[model samples]
Target: MLLVLSDEHKEHLAFLPEVDSAVVGEFGRIAVEFLRKGSTPKIYEGAARKLNVSADTVQHGVEGLMYLLSESSKLMISEVDFQDSVLVLGFPEDLNRLLLQLYLDHRKEIRQILSELAPSLPHYHNLEWRLDVMLASRALRHQVKPTVSLKLHLESGGDHIARVLQTDPATLLHLIQELERALAEAKTNHCRRILRNIK
Candidate 1:
């Protein structure tokens, strides 16, 4: 059964075992607020002051929250920095299909962009493309999703340009179109060569 917590319930998530109720509530509150602002929350003294809890209590709350989130196999959390005390929590890779459709819709433009951009690097020769998809959640089974990334590597170069994520798809499409016309011309020349040698 999916547990849908209203904002109020999220604020009062007191079921976390072995931690003070106040600490659990404060941590949940902070997490919801950070999610609202679309960024990760850093646990520190300032956050403790805002939550009206001690820095140590805030630290405990952060740990409790991590534990609670970690219990679910579908959810994953990665500690980005121990010194900075920042944690990123989100869905598992297989179920994270938010940008799948966007990339698939723009696949042609994406390929054109990579083919154009990689050759500009020094000592460039040829390029390769790989596309993969994450299986959708049961609710979104009807939708087609592609991984929201492009991996580019030059034949003669080391790891220069590794991966490119989403950035202004519309603008990238325009730029991709510019060089694709040249690629089309190249294909035509190849066709001419084959025709001349056929007989």
Candidate 2:
């Protein structure tokens, strides 16, 4: 998957070229630490003093690195794909290699941190559905109308929520078909690539 950096991120990371490779490595470490322990203004200030740059510039540079690593890890792109993704930044060969090495070294740990940070949401537990057919009515004799009733159960954080829904058979069938179509689309290569880049 190709990770496309936004123009703003590109501008923010532009300061990296002037910095030393060891400083870039330090920025990578700081980025990961920021993810795990939140931001530290004092450290940024100290780095800014050492690099003779503004604290805001140092902060933005670290943040840009964080965004790069996190997005690459979230997509789990292969090494070649990762190298290709960073190539757009127009960094020198050694800088690109350093960034790639940083990504490779911390991808797993970054993913773990991201997963922990993600919000917990309700998920499917069970579904119960019933079909009700009316064979006759006072207005319409010898007529059939089918309705579908559903009980959708969801579980979140050890708590269960149940929802009741009712719809005509035609509408229910349409919804089912639409959902199936969506599932099929999600499995396509084009859709996968779009989704990967979306992250």
Candidate 3:
């Protein structure tokens, strides 16, 4: 199913120009736009509106798009079935891999995200936003079931410690805090012991 297009999705679709593959290109663009939006359009109506092509032309284009998607759909460990003459999918658990591939289809940002940030801040420059993949994965894990969400609890000091340790932010923050607390408690104990001896 294709949903309405967002500005970002449209901008993404607009780049699919092919010298000798206009229909394939447009089909790719429209199909991807549908994927990002999470809905499949009524092919003739939607493609006609967008491309100013005849409904029959758009139908031919969509057949190509559906063929490509159906082909990839076969490669996945997941399965789709037809019930009441409608197509459906099984194994939703692994769909993340598909989405991740599509998400990386925009690699222009990866240069800024993975390469540039890995040097300057080494963790995330201003915040953990540097590892959006990490963030997104954390969010996904929590969404899978009920447990203490590392992403949520580490929201504060975790990001700072990740910057300093350049490793797992949450673990480093805990160690840092434990060391600080030990120092503070040690000072207090020393003072209390000295006062007791003098008394």
Candidate 4:
């Protein structure tokens, strides 16, 4: 059952995680005002140094609150990846296919969040473009829904992508130190062949 939060609910949600207790207090206050005044409540992200919190801590805490609200709304849920950096929730089973908004609308923050979930990083602009076009096309130009697709789709002219795929950029430059050892082996191989020819 969806229970509508009121100004009276502020003191209750205060008991949530203390990632930014004071900022949460402010959110409660704004939530109450908006509940009573019918105004849009402002979202607050607290400072890192002031809270002695890393950005991932802040991002994860915010995502926690978002999931809480999603649970309240009874949204279908699934984790998008290993780091749990991206979450996508929707109800395709309903046929009407309701997709509730479970997001913070910042592109840069999404990019930064993805950068921490290492092994690799991906382009955030491409991510945004995919989603925007999905929303724009859904049940309008097309009835097909977006399922998470990660592998780069290949085209005929993909030489640059092929080269980059050969080595991860983060490790590419770091592998240079190993080249000298390979060169030493090659030099020894050449000297051994020359000695055989002279003999």
Error of 3 at 89 (Å): 26
- Per TM-score, the best of the predicted structures is 2
Kindly list the per-residue Cα lDDT of model 4 for residues 1-199, writing each as its tens digit: 2223343333333233443445644433443333334433123234445567564444444434433433332322232221132212221332111112222222233334334433542322221112212456444864544433233433333322211124343354466657877667757968779765543
Q: Give, for candidate 4, the lowest lDDT window spanning 10 residues.
A: 95-104
- What CA RMSD would you report for each candidate? 24.9, 3.9, 22.9, 25.1
> Model 1, 2-114: lDDT tens per residue?
22334433333232333444544555555434433433435648866766756765555554443333222122212222111211223233222311222233334434433
TM-score of 4: 0.21
| Reference-based TM-score, model 1 | 0.21
The TM-score measured for candidate 3 stands at 0.23
Pairs clashing in candidate 1?
Answer: 100-146
User: Would you list the C-alpha lDDT of every candidate in the order shown?
Assistant: 0.43, 0.94, 0.41, 0.37
Ranking by lDDT: 2, 1, 3, 4
Models 1 onward score TM values of: 0.21, 0.74, 0.23, 0.21
Which residue runs does candidate 4 get wrong by more than 4 Å? 1-16, 19-21, 26-46, 75-199
Clashing residue pairs in candidate 3, if any? Answer: 1-39, 1-40, 2-39, 2-40, 3-39
Q: Which candidate has the highest lDDT of all?
A: 2
Q: What range of 10 consecutive residues in model 2 has the weakest lDDT sum? A: 134-143
